[model samples]
Target chain A: QQPVQSPQAVILREGEDAVINCSSSKALYSVHWYRQKHGEAPVFLMILLKGGEQKGHEKISASFNEKKQQSSLYLTASQLSYSGTYFCGTVTTSGTYKYIFGTGTRLKVLA
Target chain B: NAGVTQTPKFRILKIGQSMTLQCTQDMNHNYMYWYRQDPGMGLKLIYYSVGAGITDKGEVPNGYNVSRSTTEDFPLRLELAAPSQTSVYFCASSYRIMPFINSGGGSDIQYFGAGTRLSVL
Candidate 1:
């Protein structure tokens, strides 16, 4: 089953912030985030494990809510380089070793 | 080492044609998967193999077939192409456990290739 993502698209100016959310009906052992620019493969970002913790690098941070079976990605002080479609891959708790992807959130950063 | 390699970065075909998308991995991972991305839908799994000689169907397996002859190769076959099968295809490989590769918490991350863009007329 695929996870559901909200705010199909978002646009922001430089230095602005944005959020992309992903929710799944099944509990997840981990949540992985990837970003895809036009005509390119998705690049890995970070993964949040089941501890309901947060992991980040620079201006990007993500939270995994074990109880709610949801994850939220926060992009702070957005930059032009942040323009791309973000996708979330969820590893279910069933131990299937399979990943279910969200529809994706297209983020466009303007000057 | 090259993590994963997919051939034919771009291709076009007429309806009823048949073709195969080739994928090979150097990491010696035990799992390989093929997925397709349509316009507004999330990536759909076409097929997956855990190890050599074992294949399984995924969410969307219609018009497609997969074979894992050896640990290094996993190929997806499209029989009688249709416009509906025209989309971007990606090949990925991962270990059963993250950090499953060699790094931290077993984050077993998946390395993707520059996807193949297929258009069927």
Candidate 2:
């Protein structure tokens, strides 16, 4: 099933912080975060595996809660380059090689 | 490495016309996927392959088909395309994680293609 993302859209000023949440109905084995700029391919940000681990990339970070079947992407001190649509791809506990992406969260960071 | 490459960056097809979106990965990844992204929406998986000759349907596979004849190539076929099939198609590949050895640190990072924009009228 496709995951659901909260705060369909968010606007932040430079240096501001924002959080994007992704929740799945099924148990998840891993959660992958990606950001897509306008007319560009989705770029891999980070992947959070089960065991409630947290991962970070630059000022961005993510946490996965296997028990809750949810993950959250954190963007601190946002930059203009941070403006993009954030998507979360989830792999369920079925151990399949498929990834179901979330609806997406559009973040626009202004100067 | 070119990473994931897709052909025919833009295409326009009439209703009922069929076309194939080509995807190739130089990373030698074992896992490949096909997804479509409609405007203002996230990607929806159409098909995936764990390895050469091993393909499977995904969440939205009704209007499309896929084949993995080689480890480096996975193509998506749209038979009798419809207006609903018009969207940006993306091909992605990733390294499959072993059962327990690399489960904790396996690189599940999926490298994406440039995307093919298809318009069906």
Best by DockQ: 2
Residue range A33-91, candidate 1, lDDT tens digits: 99989778888899887667999889999999989999999999999999999999888
RMSD values, in order shown: 2.4, 1.8
Model 1, docking class:
medium
For candidate 1, what is the DockQ?
0.59
lDDT of 1 by residue, B8-112 (tens): 899999999999999999988888899998765567889989889999999999999999999999989999999999999999987774443223444456778
User: Taking the candidates in order, what DockQ does each have?
Assistant: 0.59, 0.70
The CAPRI classification for model 2 reads as medium
Q: Give lDDT tens digits, candidate 2, residues A1-111.
A: 678998899999999999999999998878999999999999988888765889889999999988889899999999999999999987777654446789999999999
Question: For residues B1-121, what per-residue lDDT tens digits would candidate 2 score against the true structure?
Answer: 7999999899999999999999999988989999899998888888889899999888899989899999999999999999999899999998876662346545677899999999999
TM-score of every model?
0.93, 0.92
